[model samples]
Target: MRRTSLHDCPAPAKLNLFLHVNGRRADGYHLLQTVFQMVDHGDLLHFDLRADERIVRTTDVPGVPEQGDLIVRALLLLQAAYARRHGHPPQGIDVAIDKRLPMGGGLGGGSSDAATALMAANALWEAGFSREELMALALPLGADIPFFIFGQTAFAEGVGEALLPVEAPDCWYVVIEPGVAVPTAAIFCSEHLTRDTKPVRITDFSRHTMNRTDSTGFGKNDLQAVAVSLFPPVAQAIDWLSAHGDARMTGSGACVFCAFSSEAEADTVLQQVPGIWRAWKAKALMHHPLNTVLQVSAVIE
Candidate 1:
């Protein structure tokens, strides 16, 4: 029988080990240099085939309309592309998402969800697009979407589209959600935002250990200053975690994290987090979970 559904498909969240805004293009898109670090923990997606040609999401993500959810948008994009490629409309799919990550937390949770949905839909429908093709489709959805499609610890640039795989150390992290939603546009459009930090080579990051001993493991995230200034909770969370290690904001604002050498150590810190904020112990993932699923189908590795 043909494969009808893919179960337990993981959409892993990503952390920016360091984000630098190098400059802006004439198009007003910022040039960025950062490492996309995948954490093992994130939202999960399950797909079951539908008879007609209408994609639907069964789960309701708070503060997001189903019509505007990135995953839904991605599915529509994929169906359009698939129809053009195959000369027939693809089958509809029901998407059930088990969301473990927070929205607007700078964690790449939404982008990761879109990427995971795209991969699962591609296989179930036999759309036959390569990873390269899928990344092209995903990029317009979100700049961060392509990196999740790339499915590896990667170095990203060019508004976060340019991705080249890099080896980040296997480590544990204490991620603080801070219970606040920071708007990406506010941070990007901030008058105080720095738009010209010198770019660092990927090798510079690869050479250092992410563990506690390295004071300057990677360059600082340039977004942190703008984020902290706008969102007090972000600053509070960072300050709260800084007492333990080098805590930094992962993406634009709100969520912050620090690396630890072991799960026990990470868990120890997790327990000490303040009562108001939510925190978790997450391990760095070497690759996207869908990478393994794709390999099993012998589609892409």
Candidate 2:
């Protein structure tokens, strides 16, 4: 059966359960190790095949120009790659984004959206690219894009490209948006940023503590201190949320989160969050909702 469109495709958000900056590459990319845990909250996307072979976005995304949008760039990249491999471009796509995640919040929303576009297009066009092939194609777009395509809770290293599937404990989170976008470049470039945390093995991150209210023993996000120093609102949010648990900023953020063992605990904190910031509770997901769509299996190196 030929499918012309995919509607309500989910592009779930992720929390860096912990991000450690191991060092810096000579090329200026930071070496990092983090556990990426997908959450139920994220943007939704709709894709329609375009007979004209022109990739387009049908809706306006705040602060993102159509051409600059990652969704468009992802489709074009796929289209070009498909043409080179198969002697003809894959049919174009029109994408609509239902944006939920905040930009620059370190939630990997844009990367997730691009990954969803690539996967959904591949399935709709019956493109035979393997999951690994799709992930490879996704890398040059964004480091986080490949992780989204990897489609599982992952322990990642090497500028976040090296991925190994790992278990993230089942838990709930109280995520707060602090109303400011923390630029990733600024956080990474800050002199105050910790660039030399001793690297730890995957086993060092025990899943046993993941569901505990005290996140104290867990590895920390190296970027969080820099983010807090630069963005006062982020610090404020973190301070406010910490009363409930071991609250920490996720990603490079303007958002901070704390884990809870039960939905009720997370919800209680969510209700008490100051009216000045937007907040919600989300459950950890072991795999991407779209994981079943990919029919191929290949180990991630």
> Tens-digit lDDT track for model 1 on 1-301?
7799999999988888889999989988999999998998898899999999999989888888999999999999999998888888899999999988888899988999999999988889877888889999999889999888888888888899888887777889999998888889989998898998988887788777444332225788998998898889999999999998889998886799998878898899999998898889888987787878866332234
TM-score of each: 0.95, 0.95
- Model 2 scores worst on lDDT over the 10 consecutive residues at 292-301
Can you list the residue pairs that collide in candidate 1? Answer: none
Candidate 2: which stretches are off by over 4 Å? 207-216, 293-301
* C-alpha lDDT of candidate 2 relative to the true structure: 0.87
Model 1 bad stretches (over 4 Å): 210-216, 296-301
Model 1 weakest 10-residue run by lDDT: 208-217
Tell me the tens digit of each residue's lDDT in model 2 across 1-301. 7889988898999999889999999999999999898999999999999878999999998899999998999889888888988899877888988999999998999999999999999888888787789889989888999998898889899999999988667889889999999889999999999889999888777655555543344789899998988889999998999888788888889789998888988878888888999999899987888765444342444
Candidate 2 structure, TM-score to reference: 0.95
Residue 26 CA displacement from its true place in model 1, Å: 1.0
